[model samples]
Target: MPHPTPSPREIFASGPLTGHVAVPGDKSISHRALMFSALAVGESRVEGLLEGEDVLATAAALRAMGAQIERGADGIWRINGVGVGGLLQPQGALEMGNSGTSTRLLMGLVASHAITAAFTGDASLTKRPMGRVIEPLSRMGAEFTAYPGGRLPLILRGINPAVPIDYTLPVASAQVKSAVLLAGLNTPGITRVIEPIATRDHSERMLRGFGATVTVEDDAAGKIIAITGEAELRPQRIVVPGDPSSAAFLVVAATIVPGSDIVVENVGLNPTRAGIFTALRMMGADITELNPREVGGEPVADLRVRHAHLRAIEVPAELAPSMIDEYPILFVAAAFAEGRTVARGAHELRVKESDRIAAMAAALGACGVRTEEYEDGLCVQGNGGGAIAGGGTVRTHLDHRIAMSMAIAALNARASITLDDASPIATSYPVFFQSLDLLRGETLVPAA
Candidate 1:
């Protein structure tokens, strides 16, 4: 059979988006919960875990390493761990699909053991540079061989008695930092990391919960994090929080259309991951935090987003590390705000699941938003929260953010906006359309 014409959904919407939405489980936490549970001595239960391909990849890899993990119909996972430093050689390469998180975290899990493993991934993941992770693991005496400049299809020859070291992060990446910390789990002595700029701390927080001696100290320069090697980790039940990245879509949706109010429930409020919310509020978005609570060692809350007039402001480089992944949707939010939104320190976007900086600039420009691309980031000029001129089809580049952002631009656009091949959204957020529909019903938005 011939393939259908590759196209994206044309989403037309105008809203006063008022209602509650439960976002999917936190991807970062879910990955960590599975990995940490695999290293525990006993069975651990996890609820509200993201069953996305990325987390599932971690679970599968752990099961390959002799852990018994299975999902129950009650929406919880039961894991029988192999205990710390108790891993076996897998029969073949552990293919990790498109998750950098899974690949890097798994690299850490494999680095200090007596086992050897190889990993491969999809085209996009294979193309992404793995040197950032390889350098630190190498410093700790793990041998890795990759294609040319350390991309995927990489082999890790583990260190039987790994040598731990004090590693300094050259850049602000939580994945790289977390990989090194996780590798330290089987090594002796102290493994320290100096991060000049802070990234998300989900790994650090969750590691401590698992009984690792993870410490954090703030100073004039930045944050210093240290973990004691060869520590025993005890697994516990995990309640994963709602992903803030997913909530960003509704934050944009309600902001654009006037007279809209939407409540996003159980959102993860980790300060490192809440940068977009800070930026939105600074841009005059109507927002309220309700019933703040804690879940699985992370702060959780409900976000009430109401449609309001927004004005843009200059976003600094220092803030980029915190909100890095949300830039595509943040660019969409900028499209409707008044004045110009400047984002810098965005060179990191070049190496995400896609080249998000270029992707957003191109896709937003297609939707009639005035966007100027920078070497690192972009500046978007808005029409004071007015409807965008939306007659263009956005190329999604197999990026979930690219697809979702274009869809958000369609919400208040004068014409329907089309995003080509939005299927990749399933990779991270499978219920994206469903949540949008639920919010749409409450907003009374008209769509075709």
Candidate 2:
């Protein structure tokens, strides 16, 4: 696979953004749809799948493991699965690119199949901690040979007749939770995961959609999810909703850009992932949920956002799991609000593609926004709805969200904002710049 050359891109201050746009499909759902469908007995069809590099990496890995996946000219992806416990060991290493979700979730799928495989990734993905998934999967009898701290470039050998275990999640991570459930698919008995904090439930929902028996129960302790092992998955047509995480940038851009009125259509509003909208509403953003309905078992809505005077407020800690990926851009929204906005209990941001808290703090500070970084979060002082001084360039550190967030911040900037290494944006939202151009009502020619 060829990699796009990293280059600096500039986003200039624009007038009010006005348009109806749809972002790419939900990345989380896209990944699971591909994985689950690949494990089914027959051909599964998926529409509106995110064709970004991250999801493509998952598709490629599955194909390498004997799943027949193809994309038709009609824009639908069809996959012929190898069924449960039928995956063949790949001839070589699986190149996961920039997707931690792909690497972790696929590890779970590979953990009980009696196959040996090596997983490797780019510099950024190599550094992300895999131990979270490793420890739990290891308990299921899978053996791993990894770098120190459970980093990537590792080999995993699955144990036939792997033991099923009931494990409690030490952290609030959907990836870890999904990995355990996926691993349980081939075990002899039930594999249970008790999550102390609720994360995204796409895996449970989609698994059940694919004919897997997954049960979720809630108690004072938290969410208890149990999956039966050696279960057969049924293939079905899936329509993925627009990603709320990808829509966050559009929502925030519309809210902060003066006279802006835009509708983001068909966005997934699963309660687990709508915290960004809730947080923005709490900050007095004028956002309305329209045409509420369901798509592929997940709630979908068209969001209408208008320019409003935003006031900074302390974000609730419990909402962190729901909106973990939105903080970098929420920090951008906070920069345009009045007074100070405080966000905490999001130490997870520290372990994302970049140290988002530190990365956003440094980037915002460079753009003349007052921000204070903390161990868990940040306190941002708003410029009181004034134009932000954004002449400085921001280093993206190969994090897609950071690059896009800074681009949203540039809408209200006093000068053009330059971003270093915007190539990573292709990992999740390949048409992000095109969407920006549409909303801005002009072509944004990147400086060579």
Candidate 3:
């Protein structure tokens, strides 16, 4: 359950954080597993689904659209799918909560069905631009009526046997690509999407796992992805790997806090999403992979991270698409490094739950860390592992990553740090605070 009201938290500098832990399942895979399962004709069982607010919101929307989703006492999520082209019109507005992923991907599912649904979300999600997904879905013959600027609280009416268009990604966005792919599920012909820059391929991988004919070819422009529509899917038993994005917070906490040693087990190491680890190792963090293997068609590993004296390096702009969700915490890591760290080609941060580049710059400045903001990225002046001047409250702008990143910053700060609202953390990692407490080997007593 998420905190209904604002929940502020004050974090004091603590001793070495140490523990062996497992983060929640991959949020992206969890969302896809549920969705693809709901499109299969039979029962699909999912283990290790992230039971966060965002995912729960997806489940609720699916239920309204004729999917029978339930969580057993044993914690396995069982889904009975309505099959391709079988989704019913939702009875009421689909409340997306704060999940842009759910909002976008589900719109694709509805685009090829003869259904009408109204989409709505919380204040934070309502502000996010849906135009990226709407453009393609509209081209697939789905009609939309949205707020000004393509914001949420919108209406969409699907057309059966929708027209499939050959689309090219205007930007490197996995959500937009996935929305178009999902729309192709019930479409009549081969729907094509040419991506100039590759994003995460979870949707393509999961679609293949469910027996869809999704093909990819490399060309000069980038990868050309084509999906054959009106495909039948088979239900599957899926075990979601741990989220590398969630593991990032713990990885950085252990790397920057002196004397800290921790292990986060079962983290997904999909090449498309492992750029953060690459960037951290480039900056000289001691991270080792243990027992590398595959789970549910994705790479999995145990990550052992120890505190190391880090030196700053320029993060490659090419890695932006792979680890876009992790830049906030990466910024925190840069603050403790030996030299200036610069990140560019990540303008996507501006359209997230908040303007992450601007938010992180302002938040770090409040804690006495120097940072230069750019239109596309940020440059952080590192302190060479010295204690940071903290003792300030950070405004999270209802972004979970912002709140969690600031909490990690407090581990090496000279004084306590306060978060204006920690409640947003529940959207992705509901047990983030609990994991922090476990790694720090102490209970966190938030200030009143």
Assess every candidate by TM-score. 0.95, 0.99, 0.99
Off by over 4 Å in 2: 1-3
Model 2 agreement with the true structure over 1-448: per-residue lDDT tens digits: 3346887888888899998999999999999999999999999999999999999999999999999999999999999999999999999899999899999999999999999999999888888999999999999999999988999999999988899999999999999999999999999999999999999999999999998999999978888999999999999999999999999999999989899999999999999999999999999999999999999999999999999999999999999999999999999999999999999999999889989999999999999999988999999999878789999899898899999999999989998899988899999999999998898897776657
lDDT of model 1 at position 319: 75
Model 1 lDDT per residue over 57-108, tens place = 8888999999999999999999989988998999988988878999998999
* Clashing residue pairs for model 1: 8-419, 16-260, 17-261, 18-261, 336-385
Task: Report clash pairs, candidate 3.
Answer: none
lDDT of candidate 1 vs native? 0.86
lDDT of 3 by residue, 1-448 (tens): 2236888899988789887999999999999999999999999999999999899999999999999999999999999999999999888899998999999999999999999999999888988999999999998899999999999889999999899899999999999999999999999999999999999999999999999999999999999999999999999999999999999999999999999999999999999999999999999999999999999999999999999998999999999999999999999999999999999999999999999999999999999999999999999999999889999899999999999999999999999999999988998999998999999987777769
**Which pairs clash in the backbone of model 2?**
none
Indicate whether candidate 1 or candidate 2 has the larger TM-score. Answer: 2
Error of 3 at 366 (Å): 0.7
TM-score of predicted model 1? Answer: 0.95
Output the number of the lDDT-best candidate.
Answer: 3
| RMSD of each predicted structure | 2.7, 1.0, 1.2
